[model samples]
Target chain A: MTRVHDMGGRYGDGPVRPEPQGVPAFAADWHPRALALTVAAGGLGKWNIDMARHAREALAPRDYNRFAYYEKWIAALADMLVSEGLVSRAELTDGQGAAPGPEGPAAGPVTVQKVRQMIANGAPADRAASAPARFVPGDRVRTRRPAANLFVDGGHTRLPQYAAGAEGRVLRVHGSHVLPDRSAHKLGEGAEPLYAVAFAASALWARPEHPRDEVVLDLWQSYLEAV
Target chain B: MPHDHSDHDHPHALLPPDPALRVKALETILTRKGLIEPAALDEIIDTYQNRIGPQNGAQVVARAWTDPAFRADLLRDATAVVADMGFYGRQGEHIVAVENTPEQHNMVVCTLCSCYPWPLLGIPPGWYKSDAYRARAVREPRRVLSEFGVELPEDTAVRVWDSTAEVRYLVVPMRPAGTEAMDAAALARLVTRDSMIGTGLVTAP
Candidate 1:
């Protein structure tokens, strides 16, 4: 299903307001804390990044549209904490803990030093290529259309609705990486060969504003089929 | 009206608690549960707010413009080159440097989520994460560029990179003219965050 967050080529939102250079990273005091808490809690490792993304995407469309950027992060983080048995909804709502925490190998005290090290050494997503890449640069391909039964609510996808089923040319091949479709659902990593596909703006939109322009998307191989 | 003993200064209290209060409550709960550390939170905040940002990207851009070999390395394998320069981290696990030339222009966007090169450019600007940019950039990039005060020639092809996967993109904007005598640091000062995002161009100062 095309979730509300999959907003590409849709219109009438508003004009872009470029903030002045050197604007503070957080607009308000809570913004940074929200971001930091989300990152820190994520280190608990109960859920992966894709699962966290799914939690956010699962927000009701109205709520997703209403919440500010960090608000979504905070909301999703709270949901994950409760659902993962790390915290309780009562704890979140009442501003106090009501039960004992889960027993496990203590995941963290993710210290400041540890965070700094984590930042320097990022969580690399590239996994060993399960098989040879099915396509290469200069190959013609088309993104697969979502099957009617496929991608219902909670089915996460990296393929935006705008480029679905659209024909494009492969610009480059990025080796296997974790596919969100499977990872978000608690399925295996299901790494796949990713590609940079270039589609003509005219092809993506029926009414061409700039026919000479192009829209390039980095898509996993599963999302595409040989044209 | 019945005299109630709840803390209701005004009718606005009928609404949900302020996000600040909500967040503070979450922090308190998480800390109590030992799921997170406040000090680590402080570190994450400080690192993004102060240490990493567009200056890193500007320095990379400056180096690329002044050093052809470095520029070639950047365009060829941005991940290794930038890591060699010590700018590798989360949100920037894999990097691709798409150069903006006279013939073509490149812009980056993530419609699904706000995926940016945080190690290089820090947090994305508010405008980049806005609904309008995510919706309109790929469909009408020329118009979006114009809104950002960039008036590209009609002949120049605009390439909009929708970051749908793990790979993050950085636009290596063309070096401005009349700066041949300036050093890399001086040129770095002229590179704006938007230029590296493909919304604005570097102007010779």
Candidate 2:
């Protein structure tokens, strides 16, 4: 159940190409518009950030790979609008209004002034820590191994496939924060203590290309166990 | 094995290839539904395109390079220190400033999604979000750094920070030599976006 979006440590994707000098923030004129649309629609308070990510991740593998970056945003935003009952598929396809949209508890349409305020006051995910952190810096820990089913229910997770079950040392303790695994599934924030775990290069890959190199991941308390 | 094309029942195949047209249609429909405001969309685009960007990150790096106290504060409590500079916003709610010394080099990547510090660095660059980078940066950082024309010393340890949680990281690159006399503005100009991301290094002008 490892989705294509969880692409860490897999091979043969291709070479990295840096954008040309002084390239604009966006390549195409429509790119910024696509980003703006997604932001504005998201401001309606219909879904949280985790749900937005889940919508994009839920795309079919073929479509996920085939669509360009902003194209994926546009596609996912379209599907969310329809599925959330904000708009109808017919309205989108025909470019016409079929009926008056449902008046749910949506924060009214975002105005220009609100856009500046919202962008400055971006959504903060850090929640109040209910209990003391389980691990501390310098403590040895291991990431949780996925069960045999491997999340067939398609719950959203921040744990990449490469880091699963790897032994590492805690580098720092970042207080409680929302766990995306539950947030994406309409579950509660499930706030938990997060840690910065450092795994040596040799521990992750079969061959030690750079023995001293290391990879650090911000893992939740639930994802780690004392080793 | 090649992808089987026989099963062409993908629902999204009906989507128009021209994204501009699709976006326009979607916007029109959403406006009619009173779900989104066009002016708000304009403001969102303008803010990221014109106001927020790498210059903000460069300013922070410049201040850190010139002021010892500021640098220490950045490494110890980046969230508060950075917000004091008016660089607080989404994707940067919890910030960690990792400094690069002669012994250790730090790099940032989000293997899960494009989780970048938008308020400080604006939108992520195209290559930063590419599948190749997401897949290889964690496994083969040395090779990835070399591809970006950055080669570290043999003994320098490379630490790749993968953004798995909400906590975002900003790499405080080592200041280049022969720039002690330069002012903060000049020093800021020397700090590129890639340098702060740890893919490239600052060079003296």
Candidate 3:
């Protein structure tokens, strides 16, 4: 019997590969399958021509409300994936499960690249270590206008268009890099940690008067600055 | 095809009107009549809700509840803290948090969209997100509460929070009647979800 572990964890196409015969090597392996699953779970199954038409119609002016409605459909796609077994419940719930144990039935080594790919591929994205947070609770900060995509809907996606670059304070540090729950269903790899970030109001607005007028946002680490 | 009210929720009913057509309608009526331009209306909507909405109320309530010396702070700096929380996104800059006291209770509504205080309170509840709650929250708030099985004393003042623009509102319900003896988590439980929206108050059960 030839040992496959000698290849340094890379999925090589050699005859000696033993056990777990059909696993794909890169994160993009199951893209189509995953997308199909997402679409199905997002309530797009059976293709409601009328509903689609309405949603398309609603998007003519690109208002946030239309986007919110679209999110429901996207969420339905994620739900379909979970039901169909293309995505596992463990994967969905373990966006922060880096505790060095059995990851799953197909447990294998995880890499930072894999983590990034999971996020890009629509899994939930937690906090990233590349950009560590500087401010803590009691520290004041301002929201900066960073360039990013703002989805107006409320499904498995990133920050709402209405909340991009909004500012606040650090209410609590939910450990290290965790997934941002908002996009976790679409971007997570089933077991990783995403960071949690909080922002305040006075930091974002000008001359206003309430003290507790503070708002707390659970942001990914990638969405922060020192100020 | 007879118009059947019973079969109204046939999935097709949920479909919304087209945006371009709605925009055209507004343009023809408002812009042509010199009432407003498309860009101007967009800017106005954005500014009203984002720069001056719910964050305004939260700041006022938070300040007053936290500091005895800041009643003036509550009134004057509503949106300032909203800025602090970076609540200045697309439609949520102008914000406010309302306080519900022993003498008064506060509730919020958005005659349009489910506009809410996303920065502070997270997402709005399913009930608040429903049209029934929004439509009745302002007009017959007391009656709606009765439907939810919540009855208030006749003498208690009721304040309804109507959110226009992106100015959302949160009810800082007076700390529960006996909540002074409780901890934060304990207080949190007593802070029923409905109480935060001003539809109900926390009771020590």
Candidate 4:
């Protein structure tokens, strides 16, 4: 159940590295193509962002440390293309295999205008929340550990390990959105009320150094229980 | 993108690991299938390369520093307010601006994954996506901040926002002393990506 991607509060990897002040967005020629392939495939409107994330995290845990950031994107893109029947494994491996097209107009050679429109109008994650809002702002809540049936392999989650079983106060109620835990699994994504729960530094770690500090996590209603 | 393919790497490492060749192969395959338009790819690339980035976030922070009503508006509805200024979408759809004051300072991190406001901040810096950062940012933020040369008063409460859902946070850092004469544009220049991320501070002029 412990996916290597969920790296909250784990120690001993290495020191936090310094970032270059101005690394170009596309550091290499492949970088732009990697971004394009993923973005273009996404334009098909077949999968949500959660599924894309799962595909990335789905990489072998051993490979997590080895692959570069965009490398992960390429790997995931290849997997998604093949598994979704958009491309075949042979095409991905040797660039020779062909894939079947869906009915109607194929969303290819995405137009420049379409790109601008998509960027201008951000993908609002506000789904149609069905249930009434459960907890309001200022309510005490704790993050529930991943429920048993949440995932088959127990791979991906927005819920970090540090906040599990930890208590915090609801700072604000972010209107209901698709709960990613379910969405990643292609399961039912019943929109639910989400809250910004704030926990003291002492609550998350043992014998905290910065007691004055706190962490606020945006937790969905299902991941929380009243304290 | 530097490829670090060690001779001691795993079996999968032996595949077409050259980034350029690999991407080219993928692109060729997609093009053959009519799945990707190079024009669309150019727009996407140009957007991240030239159009939007952290400067957009700095402008927002600068406006908040100089304009009171806009600050209130930003705190109330940052997504719409930020969108009003023409910076909205993607990783920045729902923004919640947490102000840094003498009492409390705010920092943003996504512990589970790297969920940054790409529309505002463009792509996150390399460090922000590191496994070390994703793990340590929450456990020892002060140390991490210090490592980045950011020092806060011991009394000031540090609030780290682990952006877990669609909502993204922008840290409205306190303006440095003796900057009252400066205009929004000048103040905006003083703002750094790290300051907004709360790992570093805006230095006093």
Evaluated with DockQ, which candidate comes out highest?
2
lDDT of 2 by residue, A1-227 (tens): 45678888889988888764222468788899899998888777777888788777777888889888988888888777766777665676677554344653244567787777778788888889966798989999998876111232555778888888999999999889887877765667889898999999898898756889999999988888999
Real contacts retained, model 4: 0.61
Model 4: docking quality category:
acceptable
**lDDT tens digits, residue span B1-205, model 2:** 2221212323333446688887877787777666677788888887887888888889999999999999989999998999999999867888999999999999999987788888778888999999999888999988889899999999999999999888889999999999989999999888888887889889887
**Error at B11, model 2, angstroms:** 7.5
Off by over 4 Å in 2: A20-24, A98-107, A147-152, B1-17
Whole-model Cα lDDT per candidate?
Answer: 0.83, 0.82, 0.38, 0.77
| Chain A TM-score relative to the true structure, per candidate | 0.92, 0.91, 0.35, 0.88
Chain B TM-score for each model? 0.91, 0.92, 0.59, 0.90
Give model 3's TM-score versus the native structure.
0.35
Q: After superposing candidate 1, which stretches have Cα over 4 Å from the reference?
A: A98-106, A147-153, B1-16
Winner on TM-score (3 vs 4): 4
TM-score of chain A of 4: 0.88
User: Which 10 residues in a row give candidate 3 chain B its minimum summed lDDT?
Assistant: B4-13
Chain A vs. native, model 2, TM-score: 0.91
Query: Whose lDDT is higher: candidate 1's or candidate 2's?
Result: 1
Model 3, B44-87: lDDT tens digits are: 32333344333333443434554565644434454555555454
Question: Which segments of model 3 are wrong by more than 4 Å?
Answer: A1-227, B1-66, B70-72, B82-91, B183-189
Give the per-residue lDDT of model 4 (tens digit) for A1-227: 44667787788868877775532345677887887777777876667888888777777776666888888888777776666667655556676445535652344445677677777776787877777788888888888864322544554567777778888898888888987777766677778888889999899998576768898888888888899
The DockQ ranking, best first, is: 2, 4, 1, 3
